[model samples]
Target: MTIREHNGVGKVTWKAEPDAHDYPAAASYLSLIAPGAQAGDLVGQLQTASLEHYKAKDMLRASGLPLLPPDNPHVAADLAKVKNNKALSPVLLIRGDLTLGIALQIADGYHRVCASYHLDENTDIPCRIADHPGSRVSALAAAVGGDLVNDSR
Candidate 1:
């Protein structure tokens, strides 16, 4: 468990890595935006990805997702876990495409992010982040000897 103190609420503890189930959960969510194989690839990368930390406020800003209310059942449950000193499972994410104006994908743990925000926006949440397959098109094109346009106009 890792601890970080905040002014409004007490310390929030986080697991060293994402829970084993988190990968499947992330794959399920990713499938909504990508094909099944791509989603699976993303999850595979997440499984081997290094752990990282980012502030709750920054994540919300990057994700462009509204904060779930503290009264929300899921968020409340996470809050209860914090109160009970139980560590939260790290989040899983897919890096956003700035060129495409795509927002960061919080594949799993949206509730936990909101819960952490309610406790303290500055809370540093642990996560495993993976790049979207679209971002790797350049490398794929290079290997296949194909040229693609950057149509981001």
Candidate 2:
């Protein structure tokens, strides 16, 4: 869906298939951070994100697409194996405009994206998208923080 300002209310133009590759950086980052977040909540957050922040996140995700040596090589290797085996997980989290903005600010899922790239340079995993409308970066960050805490154990 495309988001535009119309008559003061935000306008969303839905598409049959979302262009995952075309996703804005911030929203994508939020999806990576939340993993399985609700679409509605994500949209709400995206709507609230500042344009500059959103663009910054998008640039970060894009720049990190290529994996370099000595940085999470194990994860990168795991991604490669998954790609080689054709067994990469299908579940993905996609976000709309607002959540995308918040994600850009938090820079979530750098490792995961890098790993995914390492595994299969051409793989496009299925994503479950969120559409945040009125959320903030701190809230998204908190959600990511919780995930980190949970994964640490």
Candidate 3:
């Protein structure tokens, strides 16, 4: 994953080929990366949730990480759900080249990353990053690429 600037806002973006290794955790994180979502808020919640998941499990495999005591009860509860399932959908945060700068600074998937720290703790998430010089060209290019650009002005 990489951070980039886009439309005067900082954003997170990723680029990776679709593969089996990618998981739901990444997808979940991507859903929350939006204009209004705060990085700190999401990261905290994700970490708490991951810890909660760890605590509930009796014995985790070598692939999993142990849960740590949580500062907030609410997060613990959310993480419990994740733990019970033993599997999560991957969330992805992706942006064209232009937004890479913003995404990196904001650390778009910070929450999920934090959560991963407690859950898997050793692996990196699947991030699909794109490279756009800046919004002026990237945004416009994305629109054109998607066929959303009607006016050529």
Best by lDDT: 1
Clashing pairs in 1: none
lDDT of 1: 0.87
Off by over 4 Å in 3: 1-78, 95-101, 105-110, 127-153
By summed lDDT, which 10 consecutive residues of candidate 2 come out lowest?
48-57
User: Every model's Cα RMSD, please?
Assistant: 5.6, 15.3, 16.2
Tens digits of lDDT, candidate 2, 1-153? 222223422222223232334335434555665544543355444343322212212433534344544256656554454434423222223332343444322233344444544433433323233323344534565777723121211
TM-score, every prediction: 0.87, 0.32, 0.30
- Against the reference, the lDDT scores of all candidates come to 0.87, 0.37, 0.34
Where does candidate 2 stray beyond 4 Å?
Answer: 1-74, 83-86, 94-100, 104-112, 119-122, 133-153
Task: List model 3 lDDT by residue over 47-147, tens digit each.
Answer: 32221112112112211323444333533543453444333323323332323434332123333444444443433344333222244544565667834
- Between candidates 1 and 3, the one scoring higher on TM-score is 1
State in Å the error of residue 38, model 3. Answer: 18
lDDT comparison, 2 vs 3, better candidate: 2
Residue runs of model 1 more than 4 Å from their true location after superposition: 136-153
Error of 1 at 24 (Å): 1.1
The per-residue C-alpha lDDT of model 2 at residue 100 equals 46
